[model samples]
Target: MIWCFLTPVLGAVVAEQYLGRVKTILYSAAIYGGGLAILVLSSLPAVQETVISLPGLLLSLFLIGVGTGGIKANVSPLLAEQCTSPGQVIRLLKSGETVIIDRELTVQRVFATYFLFINAGCLAALASVEIEQSYGFSAAFAIPMTVFIIGFIALMTSKDQYNSSAPDGSIIPSVLHALGITIKHKGNLNCTRPALEPVESRYQEYPWTNSFIDDLQTALSASKVFLLYPFYWAAFSQLLTNFISQAATMQTHGIPNDILPYMNPITTLFLLPLLDRLIFPTVRNLGYPVHHFPRITAGFMVCALAMLYAAFFQRTIYVSPPCYDHPRSPTCMHGQVPNDVSVLLQVPAYILVASSECLASVAGLEYAYANAPKSMRSLIMALYLSTVSVGTFLAMAVLPLTVDPKITWMYIVLAMAVFGAGAALWSVPVQRKEAG
Candidate 1:
């Protein structure tokens, strides 16, 4: 996971320094497809028996990671580039009404749409579990490989139609240059100094524009806000591992154990449209501020609530199971008569987390791009996305508590941690104001 998260920074560096976004993405498609092909081959029973080497599996994963890295670093910036308007535009409606098109909201909508399609892809991927069960692992792996091929073809056909950013050389030299200047004049660099160099004069020695410096400050400020995100992602990451375990302890009523994780994406699919179309617009109409901070803070609280519910769900499962005290016993496994609680009851928790994604995850994407300087957008976005890996790392510390009986406590502790992080996140702007 760390490799998966960190590889994108390398891609971002390559994109920002050498090849442009379009060519980088095109290059990634081939690598990504080849990796998937390798994965498909690895799943074959014949290959599994002899030819499936650990090095081969690791290499395939590495290729996939790099390919995803290039695509991940560029895709968001590319989508955001399509919305050329940077501020609100007032438009007269044909029906004699008026609407203000806010650029931030427009960007938010683009990300929402992006997430919708992302989850739509997830829905398709989730179906592959059933394919693996029904047909074979090769069939399941082949599905994504095929999709990657189609995507590669589509990208190639439309290569000329997309917007691309040229690599402006590496960011490292620029950073070192700034640091050298900062250290050289450390004693004299005061904002209120009367003899301070004019913005143009500063540029001559700095090797960067005044605007770049100012924007870098903004990017740094935004990056501080994201430091809290690992807690949020850690709480959310539960859905991938522990939440499914929780569901396995409950009555699925004929649903597959793997099927429950799909609820997150499925719920997200519905909530995106609800928030984008109805809920958010109504709030705006009512003269409320619908900015990123408020949305993200609310998301954290919602996520905390979701985990609280999960903790309770796990507690209930402990008491009602066939194994009783032995939560990990084979009698408690799936295909056995599940615990007294119905898996459908877990829906609210899924919905809450889904709302968190709409409020926090999608907003995080918009916040990363909207707040970042143009020169550092991909790097900043990569930093934001890496929070997932950070959170996963944090979860590793609590791995011992992830087992059956201690799992309830793990959820409780995580929920509390997230709530605290959310509150801290909410206080950042306040702290900034105080510092200013």
Candidate 2:
């Protein structure tokens, strides 16, 4: 289940206003890491009976949710905290800041964040299969705990690279004020607050429109940059999540059965550094800023093509039926075939998927942070991540509406990409003007 973005962004705003984002990330990471440990210890295994297992699974999900809430709520503010001035930020955006863009540094951060994902995923990918294959259920149950401890150690050793403070006074009131404005008008079909927190610290009277539709139209239409924005982030996230269950996975033939899931982790681990160090910088360096939308658009479309490859991979490649020991197996025809697709074809599909990830994922993060209002970095990041959650929910939700098989779940994702691309194109003119 998705949690709203407001909570963590609010926390970051308050803490940065009164405390600091560096401290926020430290505290955020701690709380999130703590939740990971809980999920590790308590999450139910595949064998657990439904009556006794559902609650634990839900609880584990809830704990992971807590960490997501914490990390996303503050990460943008934490990164932005490292910067000096707005003018310097603009220049740094073009030049590429050492903190965000250095090859070694980028690799390290990607390893820290993404490798953390892979290693954690390995619990499901490798350890579970391992436990099931060799040690049995209890060992699989225990694997996540071991992995969590490693994560804890990794987080503990990671240095505090971000060290900056709130500019002067409050970021709290504008955030709170924005929330109040949002909520007070939430049910009002036609209400709009023209005065979004003023440039000055003090609040000023803004134009409050009675028609919400008119106000929304004004915002998108008037804000040309956002209106014209391309569909890159929307498409990238949609593709990855839409095909979450599908992968170009190879078999663990002649090896222990339990380690098959580990293939994904291993493959991911090997590719991430290559991506961060070589592919990402090359793409970013090739006529960025001016060709920003097009670069990301190419990434989005490539990812779509990868999904098509995965679908084909799943369909083709003749997998022979399993030989049942039972003489009267009640026609176990489907059971005879391999549940997974062949690994020989999985490599290139994953390469395509991973490369697309490198092209768009982190670059988009940097892009969003660059575009946000000075004080609303964390909020924007939360919203950006929230789109992933929203896009996922939409995929499931649209199944009933389009009922046509031609318009499958992935089609919704494709459609969203198209919409986002249109929006981005519309918004670019305005954004460039604002930047200029």
Candidate 3:
């Protein structure tokens, strides 16, 4: 959240003082890229012990997070403003319109995921060995920085296509204009029919007071729909962040640190489209009546199942490191499947988790954007992401609690997964006749 403390305010200064959005993206990317580079360089064990103390490392992480936070938050709004039509705005608007389930965006993202996620999964499969043998964490991050630089170069080279106005081409004027339109609308309504009586007279008849009476008088009341979405997403945010580490810890008995990479790949790939070709057409078919809730519910159901699968893994394999944790020793931290139970038993659980992730997360992106209102799209999108932040925050908070019942976190994930499924199932009927 503090990302705004730097990016919008500081970036606004940078834009005014010397550069603009193009420069902002470039420099933001560079700063972010540079931070990643520094992080990688300093992660070298020798360098870490000497130069990067834990506090210093955390501070660097915070700085980097702040820079990227502002960049990403502002970038999409900038892009939308540059589009030529309300068609683009409409499309962006449509992205947030729960009444119009966004199939095109859904198709685009799913297709992108088919390629990107699988490749990411594949790379993740090889990541552990690569990290150990290559430059470790620093080198891992450096690789992405190189990619970011290339990305910056590509963005710079690309020609600008759309030249749309920014909500009236000026923030102050735009805000005033919007507010004026709203006020004029209210005045028109009241003037046409004074049977409405003086609202102030009504207030006088039933007056309620507060310390901030003046402020309350001026403010607009919020819509009820705004309350619904954040609730749905909050459930989601809790799931992945809380569950993943717990699943990992429970399954780690016989698992080699190196082989652990495959666990996630196994899980995620299982959830993703088995074939890239199937994704677009499947989504295209869903475009018929915009049955978004059903799709979202299906995703949630899968997520719930994933946690049950995890519960099984946690309950069974969470004890007595029998082998793998002691690679050189005779005893292994293995499970109770067979006399010759190999490390491979963990694959089922990983596959289960991955399947759940694909169902929950990908749809979640589509759901969040589709469900939000137009003017608040970016903020709502951030709100969707913030759920993950909340979930991760919950996870970190819950991590230490494992020492208690040691079984509580398992049930917690199960509850989130179940609650998510229930919520998604309930929301389905709302959009059944609606566009989204």
Against the reference, the lDDT scores of all candidates come to 0.79, 0.47, 0.46
Among all windows of 10 consecutive residues in model 1, the one with the lowest summed lDDT is: 187-196
Tens-digit lDDT string for candidate 1 (71-146): 8888998898878765779999999899887777777888999989989998888778889889998999898899
Best by lDDT: 1
Please list the residue runs of candidate 2 whose C-alpha ends up more than 4 Å from where it truly belongs after superposition: 1-19, 26-30, 33-37, 40-57, 76-80, 83-162, 167-292, 311-335, 338-343, 397-436
Model 1: residue 170 alpha-carbon error in angstroms: 4.5
What lDDT tens digits, residue by residue, belong to model 2 across residues 139-227? 66566556656765775676454555463244445444444555676643232344344345235554333343343333333234332
Q: Per-candidate TM vs. native?
A: 0.88, 0.60, 0.60
Candidate 2 lDDT trough over 10 residues, lowest sum: 320-329
**Model 3: per-residue Cα lDDT over 46-70, one tens digit each:** 7778745565566657667756654
> How does model 2 fare in lDDT?
0.47
Pick the winner on lDDT between candidates 2 and 3. Answer: 2
Instruction: Return the TM-score for candidate 2, rounded to 2 decimals.
Output: 0.60
